[model samples]
Target: MLNVVALMGRLVADPELRHTPQGLSVTTFTIAVDRSYARPGEQRQADFIDIVCWRGTADFVCKYFQKGSMIAIDGSIQTRTYQDKNGNNRKAFEIVANNVHFAGAKNANGNTGGGYANAQPEYTREAPPAAAPSFAIGNNDDFSVIDDEGEDLPF
Candidate 1:
């Protein structure tokens, strides 16, 4: 059995960190994810997805992420049924975040925040190897030209 999800979207609001009765950290927030395609002449749509984080991941989100920030989350889908205040039963689906990360460039202040334990490494370019291997670029004798004009070609 496999259950996994990866999402990138803008935060709808600041994450509010909470704690369980046993002192475990937790946070729940929503993100707006734009649809991949839109109808002709119509505006693109977006879906508001709920996400939940636990322990250190929850604290990282609350401390570094805020309203409108681009966030990346890796997690699994979770569902639960509960009774609403109006006495109606409802089912809720959300992602139980295993990891959360920054998904966009730095702000005007040039601050990308101090990375957490699971944060990905910053993007950097490394110099090429000193002794670059040379390749034969003009060697046409190793290739064969096809004369068929698509009539005998297999699709």
Candidate 2:
């Protein structure tokens, strides 16, 4: 049997982080995933998915991520039953995130600023190119000669 799920979407709200009795960090947040299809005259729909992270992952998410930040989640779907304040048993479903990654551009502080700033790719210039590689075609006993094919070869 297998149970696995993956999602890439924007957060509907900022993650709420808390500590349990044993001082374990936990965080919960909702992701707004847009539907793949939409009707001719209707607006696109979004699915609100609940997600949970634990320990170091939770702490990292709480510290770096924020509402509207795009993220990728690798996890499994989980369902649990709990009683509400009115004593009604409720069944809840959520993703138990094993790994989370920032899927969008970062802010000046290297964190996803959510809606605090316009989303833009941060660019940095590359260093000067290095010298060309030296090729050795064969062993000493059976040597072979090779020449540069120029830059026209297909990758």
Clashes in each model (backbone N, CA, C under 3 Å)? Answer: 0, 0
lDDT against the true structure, per candidate, is 0.88, 0.86
Give candidate 1's total backbone clashes.
0
For candidate 2, the TM-score is: 0.70
- Expressed as tens digits, the lDDT of each residue in 30-137 for candidate 2 is 999889999999999999999999999999888778888899999999999999999999999999999998788766675554442335466799998998986677
Against the hidden reference, what TM-scores do the models get? 0.72, 0.70
Return the clash pairs for model 1, or none: none
**Model 1 C-alpha RMSD to native:** 10.2
Model 1: weakest 10-residue lDDT segment is: 111-120
lDDT of 2 at 3: 83
Q: Of the candidates shown, which would achieve the greatest TM-score relative to the real structure?
A: 1
